[model samples]
Target: MAESSGGPKKLLWVMIILVLLSSAGAAAAIYMVLDERDDDNPEAPSEEVVESKPPVFLTIEPFTVNLADDRHGTRLLYAGITLRVEDEATRELLETHMPQVRSRLLTVLSGQEAGQLTSSEGKQQLAAAINERLSEPFDENQPPPELREVLFTEFIVQ
Candidate 1:
């Protein structure tokens, strides 16, 4: 009776030892895989992080324009445009040609419709067109402006 009781206790201890060993092995394997992945990755976080220049933001005065319409009444669009630029030099360049930029924006905005500006796709297309027009050379010999993005801080149609 004593020997039989001891047999079960020994078996239980062996099972507990096996479970502990398996868990330890699994943990070690996971650690090794993660370590290997980090070593293999080129953009590892272990390297030093270099500080980058913040994007330059320039806000233009809001625009209120009558959208093209065929109905009995007029449709109006009000938008505040914010431009993202690369550097101080680019911003300075834009400042010098602000009049031309505003003129071009007005031309583009006047061509849009209330229904067109209401949709997201239409808004994006308008943004793209404005970016293109703004980035174009003011003169035949002048270089294109370095305008990164055009964001509408305020956009409304009525």
Candidate 2:
């Protein structure tokens, strides 16, 4: 009789544990379903609006550089550069480093041959070279800015 009673007590404890576990599992399933439903609803709080930065341009003063002259006589190239920059910060940085920038540009412009500076194709090539020069790392701490274009506002070869 005592053994039979102990068996009934053990069976009752196991049944209670199983019932508790089943209840917890059901509750978890319901919570997951509710979470998925919340995601499906369009009335949920949305993501924040990201502000966009506008395009900025920086213009450098005209460069009057003497080309590599030959028997054709002394030649000059007057080029005014306008940089289409990625941001205002870059333009500000360029403004701060104007002297160094000017020196680099002058070197580039003066290196061209008179014949090379005379044609439209030559001017385009010069612009591309300027673009590359403008984007070079000027400061050791900060990275170079993205340069969209190097436009020759004034191009005269004489």
For residues 1-158, could you state the per-residue lDDT of candidate 1 as single tens digits? 34565887899999999999999999999999999998899886665788988889888999999888846368999999999987888788788889988999999999988887889999999999999999898879988888899999999998
- Candidate 2 residues 6-60, lDDT tens each? 8878999999999999999999999999999999999998898888867688989
Query: Each model's TM-score, in the order given?
Result: 0.79, 0.64
What is the lDDT of every predicted structure here?
A: 0.90, 0.88
Query: Clashing pairs in model 1?
Result: none
Each prediction's RMSD to truth: 2.6, 13.5
Model 1 spans > 4 angstroms off: 1-3, 119-121
Clashing pairs in 2: none
- The alpha-carbon deviation from the true structure for residue 76 of candidate 1, after best TM-score superposition, in angstroms, is 2.2
Please give the lDDT score at residue 154 for candidate 2.
93
The Cα RMSD of model 2 versus the native structure comes to 13.5
